[model samples]
Target: MSFRTGKDFEFDPINGTNIIAREIGFKQTTFYNSTLTGTHKIDALGGFTVNWYGSFGILDQYIPLLQRLQYNQYTNLPGSPYLALISNGLSQKSGSVFYSTLSDYLYNAGGDISKSFTLFGQNKR
Candidate 1:
């Protein structure tokens, strides 16, 4: 979703009346996550009993631009600088916020083997 409105003065008063300056929202946002795991087991050379497992995973996200501006709650103003006018057009569709970006990756590997012999009540290894 996208909604853009013109007129951005957005508060620039330390004590000199406004000259016009604004900076809003995000310029860059980034994240990355990765994982890996493994397990293996082996027993008996002639009887043969073995188990194994493996896994891998990854995720990534990045945001380049998100622009929004609004200002109304700052007290203290004197007069010194003046030059403020904004015009580009107007927009209306107020409900706000809907932007997303995502990327993901995964990998897998596996192995297992087993062998056993039994009769009544006798087990020794």
Candidate 2:
């Protein structure tokens, strides 16, 4: 009639030059089901069934990089104050789901990136 769940994150600062980090977590639940009975057997299935599940994880080292770019002090360029810059990035993600009763499955994936834009009107002339 009741359930519990938990999660946690781990970090290792000694390995991989501390340039990366990893995380993991899990959850579980338990309950009784009265309708889960055999075919054409209502009185035969008089007990309750319990279901539960859980998960866990760990994290690697993480190291952040710092960089600085210098430009002509007098030139107020379009991307001044380092607010705008040419950046090319890509991302992708996929997932799926299934239904036992309907025997249905679904999946999806997509990613894209465009040129960076800056609100030039806000720049001080």
Candidate 3:
């Protein structure tokens, strides 16, 4: 959800409001030494004002996996993750209005992983 308001104190008043709603669902099934996954996204925006801007978004994901046993057995697992973000901004003036505005954003990410494996003689009997 987001909202913004602005007005010319000498002449009149200006204001606005906005709201949003969303829902998502997912499911998966697997039988083997593999994995399956799915995702969903929803977003909405609406408002009324002078020199006003806003946005909202929602994201959801689901995953299911199955692994085989070394001898005789089975394993089942399921997982899900979700995220949401909202932002709003506005600028206005009155009585010979004169102004300037600016905005900026920055992001960075990094990761690393390592693994090792070993093998034995084949059918050394």
Tens digits of per-residue lDDT for model 1 on 8-118? 333443432222333333433344444444443445565665555656666665554444333222234444333323334442112123255666676766666666656
| Residue 101 accuracy (lDDT) in model 2 | 19
Task: Please name the candidate that would achieve the greatest TM-score relative to the true structure.
Answer: 1
Q: Candidates 1 and 2: which is better by TM-score?
A: 1
Q: Give Cα distance to truth, residue 16, candidate 3, Å.
A: 16
Model 3, CA-based lDDT: 0.25
Candidate 1, which ten residues in sequence have the lowest lDDT sum?
89-98
**TM-score of candidate 1 relative to the true fold:** 0.27
Candidate 2 lDDT: 0.24
Model 2 / residue 32 / CA error / Å:
32
Quality of model 1 by C-alpha lDDT: 0.43
Write down the TM-score for model 2.
0.20
lDDT of 2 at 74: 16
lDDT of 1 at 69: 34
TM-scores for the candidates: 0.27, 0.20, 0.16
